[model samples]
Target: MKTLIILLFFSIISIASAHAQSNTPAKAEQEIIKLSKTKWDWMADKNVDSLSTLFDEKAVFVHMGGSWGKEREIAVIKSGSIHYKKADIHSVSVNIIGNTAILLNNITLLAVVGGNEVSNPFIVTEVYVKQGKGWKMGSLSFTKINQPAQ
Candidate 1:
């Protein structure tokens, strides 16, 4: 009888663990969403310190003009070469697979590039990799939308 009770207790714990694991994706989605929004804020403010920490050392950034790595991206922001004035996000979606999160943002971005202000609609893809207890952005690619209307 005591052995049966022990077995039942372990079974209960096992089921509980499985249930918790099932809910992990939803929680991870929210975390990624919040982190992405915060990243936008950092970009708009040109807060390179926060952005540098959030971005992976080998992170890649793709823009309409060209693509570059993390250091160049940070330098551009610091120099006001590409000032991310604002990002009007229309929609966002996140997918989590293992230790990777891919986020898509539909936004109308207003920015200053080479001292010229421009607003463009873009679908931005951001890939983040979970490292230990922290998440770092691995890639940011922007695809321009042809249609003007949001």
Candidate 2:
């Protein structure tokens, strides 16, 4: 009777552990979404210090015009080159692979550069990795959307 009871207890524990493991993807997705919004807010306010905190130490950013490391990206933000008049993001999808996550999103960027206004639709992919206590973006890439040919 005692052996049967022990077996049942172990079985229950195993099932609970499996259920917890299955929720990992959903939890990771939520974390990424929250991180993305926070970073966007920081960008909207032009707070380079706050924005830099979202990126990992070895993060890489591949922008439409250029590519940069974490330090270089922060430097440009500090230089006040990339200013957002109205930046909106939507259609965010998150996928997880082991400890890495990929977040794909569409963005509408409205800005003024050298007195010329520019508004464009762009697709962005941000890679995040779970490091230490929280998740930090490890890489970011953006591409412009071209209109269909008539």
**Number of the top lDDT candidate:** 1
Candidate 1, residue 35: Cα displacement in angstroms equals 0.6
Can you list the residue pairs that collide in candidate 1? none
Summed over model 2, clashes come to 0
- Residues 37-110 of candidate 2 have per-residue lDDT tens digits of 77777766778877677788899999777898999888766665766566578679999998899988788877
> Residue pairs in steric clash, candidate 2?
none
The global C-alpha lDDT for each of the candidates, from Candidate 1 onward, is: 0.95, 0.81
RMSD per model, one decimal: 1.3, 2.7
Segments in model 2 whose C-alpha atoms lie over 4 Å from true places: 147-150
List candidate 1 segments past 4 Å from native: none
Q: Please, what are the lDDT tens digits per residue for candidate 1 over residues 14-34? A: 999999999999989999999
